[model samples]
Target: LNEIADHDDEGAALQWLRRNRRAKLWISPVTLAEVLEGAEDVDAVRAYLSRYGWQGIHRIQAETAARLQRRTKHRLGENDAWQAAVAECMKARVVGHDDAFKRLAAGYEDYRP
Candidate 1:
């Protein structure tokens, strides 16, 4: 769920992401891109993940992409589509505060966290 703006941990956003990080986390390539892009230091990611290890970072693949694409509505906003693409790709319940992503998530009743 990380984004460029998420770098600013001035509020609840930071708490939400860090609170349950010990739990299994799913990530699509897009989400990976976001975290990498948002980070100020590359080594921090490696250092942070080193403890959790690769097994903790469950990467999503094409199955998620196709499923999300199939579930996505044609009328959805561009950002929403992208969001769906990533969430769907991971088959992970999205952790988004945005209205659009929330709405899209609503339609994915089968989505598992």
Candidate 2:
């Protein structure tokens, strides 16, 4: 949404997701924080996220993310690791342009538009 609001080309990913009726969109709570990090209207963003599927970080997911981070040789941010964990838990594909997810690409589909 931040990308879409800012008119980034990567915003096309969001468009593609919306157009794909067969796809189910999901986001981690960490992702919500990342999206709201620099937003001027936090309430609006919060409301927006509420409309989509939210994957909350639980003890299992936290542990999974930690294990994944420890096992991987590649460097990744905390939130990225959490998102990857969420993806693994949901057995769903990740849609984004972040290169940090390359390592997990084989486990889950990584869509960039």
Candidate 3:
């Protein structure tokens, strides 16, 4: 998302997104909020992100995120915990450059380039 917002076409994350355009990707509500919070043009960003699927946080996901946070000693912050929880609950791979995601036991694809 940051890559897209910055228009970093050469970024590995952006490249991966382009390559997987047809894949069943999903975005968490937490992620949507975070992205929009920092976006200079919220409407544009929202419109751009509308193509992906959105999964709302449920009780199980919240519980999972709490457990993950507790187990990690709060290393995975609240927002990231939610993200990880959503991905874990969906059995999906988390694609991001955040090193903190590595601290949790979730499937992760490091897009740090």
Query: Tens digits of per-residue lDDT for model 2 on 54-78?
Result: 7788998888888998996775788
What overall lDDT, based on C-alpha atoms, would model 3 receive against the true structure? Answer: 0.81
Q: Higher-lDDT candidate among 1 and 3?
A: 3
Worst 10 contiguous positions by lDDT, candidate 3: 104-113
CA-lDDT, candidates in order: 0.49, 0.75, 0.81
Candidate 1 wrongly placed segments (more than 4 Å): 1-10, 17-22, 49-64, 75-91, 106-113
Ranking by TM-score: 3, 2, 1
Candidate number with greatest TM-score:
3
- Evaluated at residue 32, the lDDT of candidate 1 is 53
lDDT tens digits by residue: candidate 3, 12-112: 87788777777788988888888888777777778889988889999999898888777755467778888888999998878888887876544887865
| Model 2, residue pairs in steric clash | none
Mark the 10 consecutive residues where model 1 has the least summed lDDT: 52-61
lDDT value for model 2: 0.75
Provide backbone clash counts, one per model. Answer: 2, 0, 0
Listed in order, each prediction's TM-score against the native is 0.49, 0.81, 0.86
For candidate 2, the TM-score is: 0.81
Candidate 1 lDDT for residue 106: 50
How many Å off is the CA of 96 in candidate 2? 0.8
